[model samples]
Target: MNALTGVLRYLGNYAISSVWRLGYGARLFLLTLLYSGESFKRFQLVLKELYSIGVLSLVIIMVSGLFVGFVLGLQGYNTLEKYGSEQALGILVALSLVRELGPVVTALLFAGRAGTAITAEIGLMKATEQLSAMEMMAVEPVARVVAPRFWAGVISMPLLAALFSTMGVFGGYIVGVVLIGVDEGSFWSQMQSSVDFHEDILNGVIKSFVFAVAVTAIALLEGYDSKPTAEGVSRATTRTVVTSSLMVLFLDFILTSLMFTS
Candidate 1:
């Protein structure tokens, strides 16, 4: 009987947590729309955060994108060369980079770099009562901290993903056309003919934007809810990464289904 009671309690808690997470998502969506409607002074914070996340993250993004493109070109050219579709290297590279790999990989990297940092910094602040102090100062912490981070993530993830895709495609072109003896016109022509702008690429970017929102929310919530202790802050940081990454992956599946299916 005791064991049965524990199982029931566990199931109840799981159900509650799931519903709580759903509500949290709905609230964040509403808050984001509200922030989008606010004054320029409020909206400008998005740009500031965007610079920090998107611009500051450029170096790593470039390195990852360039190498991925080069590798794709090498492999894709080899694979298609026997079939007389070496020109399709550009199309392969563009599809993989833009439609799937680029945004997802970039978001994973962003979660590690900016996402972890946001969680740790905010969690530490919460532990130290800095957030509380701001509240006492009549500063709405969400408006000042969470809002900027949220908007920043939403705006920057898509742009950075685009940058990664473009650079990766450029790298592929260099490898395929300049080095591998494929004609530039053939490469571009194949890519243009094979890739559709709306169905594949745009959907991926939109998904990445939603991913940005999820990661920001998980990280900020972890930080905001940290207990008043060093250990607690540390725990929150770890939880933030685990939770945010899981949410990104899960939502990617959900959003992909919703976007592609009837």
Candidate 2:
């Protein structure tokens, strides 16, 4: 009886805490958006953050995209050849990357790379009372610090996803056409014929955009809410990665179901 009561109490506390955090995060997101005008007023602030988060993440995104495409090409060829449908491998790789893997993988990588960096940087600033200093000086930290980063992530995500998809298609072509001897004409033609611009490509762009919002928001929230200490900053950075990854996967499923299911 005591154990059961204790378990119920723990569950209630957890539920309440989750709800409170969710509410707090929603409020923070709204405030960031409300204060976002300052980010554009000083466009250089956003441009700086764009370089830090987006440009810095390019190498990893491209390399991972290429390797993912290579694997898809190889595995897709092997599977298709068994059924005498080898030429269809191009469509397979292209569709998979454009529809599913591209945005999801890119967002996951962005979370681990740029997302953690944002969280840690903000967390450290908080630890050093920079945010407090800004508040004292009559500056809105959300406008100057948070809003620029938010806009940067939102703008960078879809572009990065597009670049990732492009590199993936190129990698797939190299593996499928050059190495595997799939007919280059048939590969390109089939891929072009089968992929619909609005259905596949646009949906992928939308997914990446959604992921960008979720990831950046979560990272910012974690940092802003972090305890002002060294260990707290570290923990907030770790949470940024884990939370963003889970959000991407969850949102992917929801978006896929809505977009693909009849």
Clashing pairs in 1: none
Poorly placed runs, candidate 2 (over 4 Å): none
**Which 10 consecutive positions of candidate 1 have the poorest summed lDDT?**
31-40
Expressed as tens digits, the lDDT of each residue in 1-262 for candidate 1 is 9999999999999999889876876775576556554423767777777778778888998888898899999999899988987877888999888877787788888888788777788777787788889999987677777778777777788888888898899999889888878989979998999888788788888878888877877777777666768898888888877887788778877877887676
Please give the lDDT score at residue 38 for candidate 2: 76
lDDT, model 1, position 12: 100
lDDT of 1 at 106: 82
* Best model number under lDDT: 2
lDDT of 2 by residue, 1-262 (tens): 9999999999999999999999999999999999998789999999999999999999999999999989999999999999999999889999999999999999999999999999999999999999999999999999989999999999999999999999999999999999989999999999999999999999999999999999999999999999899999999999999999999999999999999888
Q: Give every collision pair in model 2.
A: none
For each candidate in the order shown, give its overall lDDT on alpha carbons: 0.81, 0.95
lDDT, residue 203, candidate 2:
95
